[model samples]
Target: MSDPVDFRDNRGVGTLISDLIQQVSSLMQTEIRLLRAEMGDKLKTMLGGAVEVLAGGLLLMAALLILLQALVVALAHWVGAGWASLIVGLVVAVIGVILVKRGTSNIEPSNLTPDQTTNQLARDAAVVKEQFK
Candidate 1:
């Protein structure tokens, strides 16, 4: 009877497996880096929007304050008492404080991510599954 051929310790099996693992690991790392980059881009956009909103809000507040002061000055002049302007300024300041309090209470920090990426991926996977069906 012919001796059974030994197939043990095939040439470069370990090296091949190590190379494959390295390739897969590198690919996974690349994907993770891409995700982080996308997240950073989203965050930057959100920051820009927040800055614009802050500037606009501050401008509106300043304008409101100016109008309030004008109204106070006019009222004081009408009443022939310069000291009455201080009362108007105080009232406006109180209203501003209330608004600031309410605005701050409603604010919450957020993580910005693109909308529906996971859902789109799921849909794509379903389509692929259906193709095999």
Candidate 2:
């Protein structure tokens, strides 16, 4: 009868180590690819939101201009045309300043950071450390 094969031999250990190395390498590559895809998706979403906000801001500016002109016209009956225009312009300028301040406050460096990716990477590192240990 043919000899039975020995499964837990030294050669088997070497093969297992080789397979482990290859698998770990492949896992790292897949993780990197996933990270890139996720970041790309996030960037696209952020860009789309920015475009929408820009369009809304432009429309709001147009509407504000029309309203300011209407206010000046209405005030002209009570005040002289020059004073009405000046008052309306001042009010619009003040409102614009307030809006600019609020808009700026909403935009900070932290808001632009890739928070999900950062968290995911930290988790991945922890898992790798545990696996190796």
Candidate 3:
């Protein structure tokens, strides 16, 4: 017959195996936490860069709009018919709207949700293709 197993002594290997399992679990949890922290830091940096780029782009757009408005005003004054000036301003405004819409539509935000990004890209592509034709 096989020897009877001892239940009360430290010599049994069950305790050692349990300790090893626990150690491995703790290490895994630590690694996961570290990975999460690293990913969060990288996301923060990316978002900050995106925000800076967006701010700069908006500032440039504002300056361009102001310049366009000044040009429209000067043209209106030089042309000298009240109705003509109104028509010219309206046409310029419409053209400006179209250009701005096309310009901003091309800007892709990298951090958008996957579905939103895909949908926006598909829509923009369709619009651009239609515009080209």
Point out the worst 10-residue segment of candidate 3 by lDDT: 104-113
Of the two candidates 1 and 2, the one with more favorable lDDT, higher being better, is: 2
Query: Per-model C-alpha lDDT, please?
Result: 0.59, 0.65, 0.57
Winner on lDDT (1 vs 3): 1
Top-scoring candidate (lDDT): 2
User: How do the predictions measure up, each by TM-score?
Assistant: 0.44, 0.57, 0.41
lDDT of 2 at 59: 49
Candidate 2: worst-modelled 10 consecutive residues by lDDT: 102-111
As for TM-score, the candidate ahead, 2 or 3, is 2
lDDT of 3 at 91: 57
Better-scoring candidate (TM-score), 1 or 2: 2
lDDT tens digits by residue: candidate 2, 73-120 = 766665566455656666655665565555544444454566766777
Model 1 residue 31 distance off true place after TM-score fit, in angstroms: 0.8
Q: C-alpha displacement of 117 in model 2, angstroms?
A: 4.5
Question: How do the residues 26-130 of candidate 1 rate in per-residue lDDT, one tens digit apiece?
Answer: 755765666677777777766665555565566557656766766777775765343454455555556556555544433424445544454454665576467
Candidate 3: where are CA atoms >4 Å away?
1-11, 66-133
Per-prediction RMSD in angstroms?
A: 11.4, 8.5, 17.5
Off by over 4 Å in 2: 1-11, 77-120
